[model samples]
Each structure stands twice: as structure tokens, then as C-alpha cells.
Target chain A: MPRTSRAVKLAALPDGLPGPEHFSVVDVPVPVPADGEVLVRNRYFQVFPSLRTLIGGGVKGTPFPPLRPGDTLFGAAVGEVVAAPGVAGLRPGDLVRHWLGWREHAVMPAGQCAPLDGTLPDPAAHLGQAGVAYTALARDARVRPGDTVFVSGGGGGVGSLAGQIARLLGADRVVGSTGSPDKAARLVSELGYDAAVVRGGRPIAEQLAEAAPGGIDVLVDNVGGEQLQAAITAARPGARFVLVGTLAGQLAPDRSGTTAPVEIDTFQLIAKRIEMRGFGGLDDAGPRPEWTERVGAWLRSGDLTFPHVRVAGIEHAPRALQELIGGRHLGAVIVEL
Target chain B: MPRTSRAVKLAALPDGLPGPEHFSVVDVPVPVPADGEVLVRNRYFQVFPSLRTLIGGGVKGTPFPPLRPGDTLFGAAVGEVVAAPGVAGLRPGDLVRHWLGWREHAVMPAGQCAPLDGTLPDPAAHLGQAGVAYTALARDARVRPGDTVFVSGGGGGVGSLAGQIARLLGADRVVGSTGSPDKAARLVSELGYDAAVVRGGRPIAEQLAEAAPGGIDVLVDNVGGEQLQAAITAARPGARFVLVGTLAGQLAPDRSGTTAPVEIDTFQLIAKRIEMRGFGGLDDAGPRPEWTERVGAWLRSGDLTFPHVRVAGIEHAPRALQELIGGRHLGAVIVEL
Candidate 1:
């Protein structure tokens, strides 16, 4: 058993996108599992979009509290149980998915650490698809069969996997909007999206009109500024827009209500009978078993692609998160602990 | 009956809010009713908010086509059937409601005119309520009993009656937002609104926080600019916001997308899970009979108050509409011919 472990603690709250200076990776004595708990050696942790909101404080509507200085950051992690006491169904060498990430090891109640049967070869793959993506598109937005789905920030963590999940959920056509031209190209070419609209090139409404001529039925929106407004304009009557994130606020130069305000023409809003909702799946405690089983089958059979950029070592998790925020990486950024 | 009647036609599409110069009243010979048709002497017509959009051009998502330069305006009008031929329920002097207003007389298909039983005193009362407000709050938002409701454009037509309707529909408390302080005070005192927030006096979000303190459960929004944004900010999680109008857009100085845009902080949107849908009740063909019966009962029993501003003649309707658009009057604006 390892005698010591490491954890990434919130060194400081950042004014903008966080970097290594904002996080302090420190050595600590490893915690052992108590009664009904299991000691997990975390194999891989995800550097997702919510991390940007997490380090700044916390997102509203989510149950997770903000990390104070010296507090270990929390997120999704796939790990192997090294020790268990009085825990049923969980044993040593069993792969599990749980919160308490940003740490080399986590001591969690067996109930919180959901076991992953050997359906997929990579433990990191378990961190990618099961819960957040499923909840946003299938459960929340209810992406109907033959529905046209539009996802903003298609290169980011949840958004990257969301397009694929939407398609698997029976979306007839998927169009993604990305700030990066390369990411836009890759989204259409590799991620099974029918088309991709690059932001900053032209008016998104003009582009989306050409991309999805029938108008988008469902929108899994990650960036929520001009993109959201454009999506609203291009949405068909009775369309469902699932607001997954607000990168526009994060990427804003000013917080004075002057930057990138999504000006929705209310006349259009009522006329179309559009429905929009916010998602807080990342803060959820458990993954849906049905999603894991379904997604795993798809991944293993080569029907789905989970393009991930995996970084080595827990010490680099903070940097991985920064890269994810900067839109440097396309798809999920997995940090191997 | 007069051998000739006066009808108002669109003179020219106004660049902004239309005035007397934008309309021309022309004399036309009254036509006899054909088979299965009724000749109605128009008693009253509504000079409501939709008239603003109608005069500018038809609203999107509604079936109502735009009025050309010479086309006579169409709207909700309550009239007395002077002649009926080969029609069931045949009677002269029977009060009925139908489209084809802005004229002294109309020859409508017998099926088009819905008869209104003498549930209330005035024939014009039928024109005031029974459709738009009921559909917006009760049907669209589904304002539950014990729910706190917030309404924008409280002094305007639909908004003025909507508060009373929401309260009658079992809303625990009703709060309204208006630009005029006098209107706000009247909304609380004369109308059924529990509290009234004056826009342009304080930040709407701060006022709403004080008004509904518990957070708004339902929002029947008419003016969709800063007030809508404020309502979104102050909304309780899982609140339902019904989009009723875009008076802000109507009142904006420029149509270049630079004015009065509702900057929705989408982070707050998802966190609150606020659900909003558009209301197209005004453009609908018929008044719901159930609403008329229920509202008539409410009005007669003194359980509901239908506040209205009346103009004497149809010739002055164009001016009444201008006054209504300029916020010179409160509640429903009715033009008696």
C-alpha cells in the first residue's frame, strides 16, 4: 500500500482562467477506508468545463460548495479500490467512478463510489460519458428521434461528448458551433456531427440557417452569449434549448453587464414557444447505470468515439484544466493520477 | 341602419409608433349579408398593444398576415348583428364577437361571429378579458395556487387584467412592473396586484426581490428588456415565465440590435431552471367560451375587476391606439363605434 499521497488544493481564487499558480499540489498522508468506506487509488480525473466555475467559486444551482484556500478541489474521477471494510460489492482491484477528484487517492463510502464492470478497457473512458452528457441531452433536453441538435463549444469536455451522445440518443442531424476552426472541422469529420459552424467567421444565425435549414430542435449550449442568441434565432417552433454552460460570462473582459449580453428578441421568444432550461449534472453524486451500460456498449462496439486528451500525473491536473479552458484541447481532457 | 359606413385603412407603414397621419378613414357602402352570413354593426373594437405590431407589420409566429397600404385593419371587435340570413340562432340586435374590426359594419360568415350571452352589462366588456390574460397565465404558465406571480407592463392592456386573472386563478400574491409610478400605485390599489414595482425608479431586480421576497414562481412578461432580465435573476428555481409581448423592442430607439436587449445571464438561467414560452393568444381566431363564462361570472360577482379606458368612436381608434402605444392609458383600451 502507498504510505503517502498528493492532493491539488485551491491556492487562490482567480480573476480569470486559472493556471498552475492558482493551485498548490502538496504531499499528504494517505487516508485509509473506515467502516462502509473504500480507499481508492484514483486512476484518472477529468478536467472539465465546470472546473473553471469551480475554482472561481461555485456555480449557482449546483449542490457543490466553493473551494476555500487549502481545500482540495472536487470533480469526477475513475479509480481502483485498494481497500474496503464492511463494504458490499466493492473490493480491491475493482474500478469505480466517484467525486473527490484532484487527489491521488480518495476515501469514499462504497455507496458514493459506483463500481464499473469491465465493459471498456480504459478506466478513463468511464469518466467521459456516463452521467453529465446523458443527463443534459437524453434526460433533460429529451433529444427526440430525428431531432436536429446544436451544441456550442463542441470542442470542450461536456460539449465534445454531448454531440456524440445526442446522435446516439437518435438525433437525426447534429451541428456543432465552435470558436476554433480546427475543432469545428474535427467535430464534423470525426465526432459524427452532420455539420459544424465556426464562430467568429460570420454571423452564427446566417451560418446555422445554412447548416440546419430545418432549424435546430434541441440545443445543448455550453457557450451562452451571442451563440445562445443565434441559437434562439435559428430554433424551430417549440424547440428545446438545454443551457449546459455559460462560457461567455467566463470569457468576458468585463463583469459590469456590458460584455456579450445575449439579447433575445422577446417577440421571437413567445412567437416560437421555445423552451429553455439549465443543467447541473456535474454536481450530481451518482452516475446512471443505464447510461454507463449503454455508452460502454457503444464505445466497445466502435459505434461511438470519445476523443480524449490524457495528461500524465496528478501534478499536471491544474495545467490540464487551464488548457481545457483555453480551448487548446479538443474533447475530454483526462489527467492520469 | 346607415346606407354607408366608415372604415379605417393603413395609409402607410410608420417608421415608428403610428399617429393620425398613418391612418385614413374612408366611406364605403354597406353590403348586405349573403347566405350563411350576418351583417353586424360594430359596437366596439379594441385598440390594444398588438395594434402596434400590426401597424408596423404582422408579428412573427402568428397566422395574421400583414396589412398592406390599403388593407383595412383587423382586430377583436364586439358588435350587434343587424341582419342574419340562412343562419341558425338568427336574430337582429344580438351581441357577438369576431375579427374584422376598424369598420362601422362587417359582413362576416355566421360561424365567425361567436354570440355572447348577457352575462355582464356592457357589450364592450366582452372585448376586454376572456382570452389573452387567461391563456397567458392559467394555460401557458400554469400558475398554481399559492404561487407568487410577477407581471411586466402592468399598466398596459393584457398586463392590466392579467394580475386580476392570476389572483382569480388562485395565485397567492401578484406583483406587477410598470414604468409609471402612478400606474404602479394604481396596480396595487385598484387592480388585484399585491405589490407593484416601478421601473425607471430602481433596479427591477432589487424591487422584485423586495416585492416577492420568496422569489417569483411565475412571470407573465409583456415588456421584454431589462425587466425580463431582472425577473430571470429574481426567479425561484423551477419558475415558469410566459413571454407575452416585446414592448421593449417596440420602444427601442433603433432596430439595429443595439437597443434594449434582454441580457440573460444564462448561468442563472440553468441554475434556476426557469421555463418560458411565448403567448400567441391575441392572434387566435376565437375567444375561449369557458374563459368568457368564467370571467363574466367573476366580473358580475365583483370577484374580478376589468379596468378599461374607452374612446367614443371608431373614427378616433387610430388616435386611441397611438395613446395606448404611448402608455397614456391604463388597462384595456376599447373604442366604441
Candidate 2:
């Protein structure tokens, strides 16, 4: 008898805030694994802001494919293999992480799955601090000793990890910025941030100037609007600004009270002798096992900590994703399947 | 007996476009060379757009001191040594290049100057193509084999040499954008640009898309504003945009008939994974003798070419600087004192 599986499917493309109406939970037959394939029973999956770009219309000028209506939402998931067909290393009980997710069961090529080493306290840790965020900060930004590091949107998924990773990488001072005063306090008190700039209370540039004083050596930007503008203004000569997200989006209210495109003064990049590069960790098919091992070590040694908000069951995945896009939740937002 | 030398002095910091009133010709007695110092009879000195920044209140932040009134405006000049005071590597009648110009003669420590190897036909070449432009393109930008390069302001000083350097670095196809149609034609006809985009004729983004349909892999940005915005739009995944200038200034007329701050979409930088870095070349005090040697070898082999607009005599220096700021001249602008 064939097993049955349930999955969350995209009902329609999103236009800003994605509601429950844009997703549907549907039942389907579990896929039969071919030779060199594994069947995974997912335990947890992630929902982050980058999903907003994918579900809306996809990233322009890149090959990021948009999901059509009725297509299963694919994402990183930690799961246990239920069936393995002619797979040498993977067994039915083997724990693994794969990109075929947002579903109860995923049948994919064995090579696409990475078998977890069972060192993590929970498999879901693969989706949080021990994954993309760590690699993005440690490798791409290369935060070093004596460097003044700043992470914008410090309460968010990547920002939280980035702040901690900068500390582990030996940053002299790690500063973060968040939209809420509570998150701002959390960054300094709980997270590794030496200081946090709270948005909406003051112009970000003034806050950052007060915080850094000397100037920012490295800025890992997650919020792009005024914060990014502020980062540019506060950047020191030969500073490095990593472009991570546009949480502030592209448009802003102009002086006439209408939305106009927000701009970056390119002159600053030249005048200040800054280097700004965009980073998309693990998306480009680079080496990840080394990064994964290092982060795992950090976690095991208790040097790294992560907080995640969870929504139980696959049906709540859409709501969880909405909460993430709305910036209503701090830290990583994951769904238990 | 002391020799009398006439030099151009900054009369006052200019409010905007510098006029003849902002400069004055002053006579001074040339100082005798001290031990380890060399006196040079100047041949040519460069007057490019960056001077406008120094004379106009200096660069914001980072300790760029403003030129005080009556101070002789100093810059790079190539000349023959007239007096050497027991300098190990220096002697009278030896050609050398030093950062002491805007006058008929300069006296400085021999260590502050580099003796020219007498490879080029004329010493003025050291102030133009054989100097900062070569280093900025080859070392800073690292133009590589088969790269599709786009140069903004390709008719002007650095842009002209940058395009040629890209070609010599094994770029498959090079595209350039300039203000005038004549310059656009010249980029393709006289310079090594494979194609050209004429600004103001069409939206720069549209023109760039049509010119490099495959997308630009490397962008040497000299004119910032709309050109930088367009380069960001036209960039391929993992493209590198070298921030060389901000000739577009700050505010530009938007489509809504209002002056808007020039902006770049940080989201696009993330999506495209583009790396944008500012280039300062020889200004930062680094070892350049190796670079000068390689570039000199290239120039000697007839692989490199440069054009310059000369303003004769010290009195004409201010007008030449004005012409460069006005974008009236092509290639390097030099003062023949």
C-alpha cells in the first residue's frame, strides 16, 4: 500500500503581505524513491524574509524561479529518512537535512541530502544559527579582531546570528540596530552586541555615530532604507558594507508625502573608499560542510546560542511565514511538521 | 644666487564652479635643496576633477585638509632634476616624477620622488596614462579574461585609459557610456570600446541593456547618479562595479519633474551579488614601482595610448582646471608650466 503525505502548497503569488488564502494544505501520495534516492519525513522547516521575494515575483535579473500556484513551497528542512533505495550511506532511520521541504515527506536524490552527524541537540538547529547565517557572516564578511562590526535588523534571523558570529570571529565591538526598543535591549543584554541602535526614536546616523564614534569598519546591513543610508554616512574610510537584505524595501515617503525610490549616495563609496558586496550563503553551491562543522563545534562548546519561535504542525506554516514577513517575531521562525 | 619661480595659488575656496578670480599667480624665491633633497624644473602637472573636491571645502570626513588661500595647489608633475644635494639615487638632469606641482619648479626630499626610467617618449605620460589610471584598473579593478566591462564617462580622463586597460586585460567585449554623442563615437572609433552608450539620448538603463544584452560582468563607474543606478540594474550575477567618481553630483531631476536624491537599489546589489569598491590608486601611499614597471613595459610595446589637453603657462592652470570641471575636455587635462 502506498503511503499518504500532506504538504503546504502556494495557492497564489503574494502581493506584499501573504495571508492564509495564499496557501493551501493538500494531501498527496508519498513519492516512491528511485535508485540512489531517499525518502525524508520532515520534522521542521524555516520561514524567513527571503521567501517574500520568492513568493511575490522572484528576484529580478537572477535565475530565482517563482513558485506557480499549487506548487509545493520548497525550503531547508531537517528530517529523518523513512526509505532509502540503493543508497550506500543513508539508512531509513538516518537523520538528514535537505531543500525539499514544506511537506511531510520529501523524496529526492541522495546527493541533495546531507546526513546530520547527530551532534546537534535538535535537528532544527540546522535551520538556524548553525546554518546560512553563520556562513554568511564568518565567510563573506570575514569579521576580524579589532574590527568594529555592526549588524542592522539585529533582532531578525540573520542579524541575531551575525551579531554572535562577529563576536566569535573576534570583533572588537559588535553593534546592532533593531526597530523595537525591546529588541534593542535584547541585542545588548542577551545577544553578543556591544550596543544596539533603536530605530524610530532618532535618525539612525546620529544613533550610529554616538554608538561607534570612531566610525564603522564593517556593516552587515539587513535593513536598507534609512538605516542603510545612515550606515553609508557613518562608514569610515576603507570600510566594508555587506548588502544582506532590503527589509526597508526600495520605496520611501518623500517630502511631498508620496512614495519615492530611496537612493544611496554612490559618492560616499568613492569618497570614503568603501567596498560593498552582496552575499547569498549556500545558494551558490559552494562548500558548506566545513562551515557547518565549525558552527556545530561552537554550539557544542556553548559559545553559540540561538532562539527560535515555533508554530506547531504544517497547517500553521503559512501563519508562521506571515509573522516573519510582518517582522512580528524575533529570531528564527520555524514550523514543526 | 636664488632662482625666482612663479606658481598658481588658490585665492579662495570656490563656492561652485571655480573661476579665474579664485586663483592668482604669485612669485616666490625657489629654495635651495637641502641634504637628501632634489630640485626639479617641472615639465607637466595634472589638473583633473578630483582637484575640484579638494578646492571646494575638501572631502567630507577622513582628514582631507582644505587648501588655504595663497597656498600653491600641489599635484603630480614630471620634471628633470635641476639640483641634487648628495642624494644617492638622484643627480642633476635626471627625469623624475613627484607630487609637487602647480609651479615652474619643486624642491622636495629625494625619497618623495621616483626617477623615471626614460621608457616613455615624453615625461607628461607619467602624469596621465602611466600613473594612477593604470594602477586603478589593473590592480584595484582586476579586469580579467573574457569579462564584459562597462565604463561610464569613457571619454574623460580615467575612463579613457580604463577602457583600454580592460581590453589589454583580455576583456571579451567592452562597452562605454559618455555625455556627448561625439564622445560616444570616439569611444568606439578611437578608443578600444566595443560599443558606446550616449547619455541623455535614452534612459541609461535602457541603452545599457540594449548595448550589453547579456548583462555587464564588470562596471568601471566614473559618472555616478543615473549611470551608477543603470549599472546596478544592468549588472549580471557576481558582477564587480568599481566606484571611480560621482560626477553626477547629488540631486538630479526625476521623472516627476522634481529634483530627487540619486539612489541605488540595495536590493539589486543583494540579488545580483555585485561587489562595488572605491578605487583611490596611488593616493593611499603604497609600493607602486612594480606596477609602474609593468605599465611602462606595456606603454613601451605601443599597447597603451593616452591623449591630453594642455593649458600653457602657470596663468592658464586655473582655466584648465575649470575646463576639466566643466567636462569640456577629453582624456587627461594637464598644465604645461
Output the number of the DockQ-best candidate.
Answer: 2
The TM-score of predicted model 1 comes to 0.84
The C-alpha TM-scores of every prediction are: 0.84, 0.89
TM-score of chain B of each: 0.90, 0.89
Q: Per-residue lDDT for B231-261 in model 1, tens only?
A: 8877888888888777776655344221234
Best by TM-score: 2
Retained native contacts per candidate, as fractions?
0.66, 0.63
**Per-residue lDDT of candidate 2, residues B1-337 (tens digit):** 3479888899986656777889998888887889889999998898866566566555455345667787888888888899898998777889888888898889998888888766566678777444555566676667779888898888787888888888888888899988788888888988889999987788999999988988888888877878888888888888888877666651122221111136666767887888888875564244446555666677788787776788889889888877776677778888886
List DockQ for all candidates.
Answer: 0.41, 0.51
lDDT by residue (tens digit), candidate 1, A75-164: 789888899999888779988888888899899877787887666656787784445677788777888998999998776777778889
**iRMS of every model, one decimal?**
3.8, 3.6
Native-interface RMSD of candidate 2: 3.6
In model 1, residue pairs whose N, Cα or C atoms come closer than 3 Å (at least 3 residues apart or on different chains), thus clashing, are A270-B278, A278-B270
lDDT of 1 at B267: 66
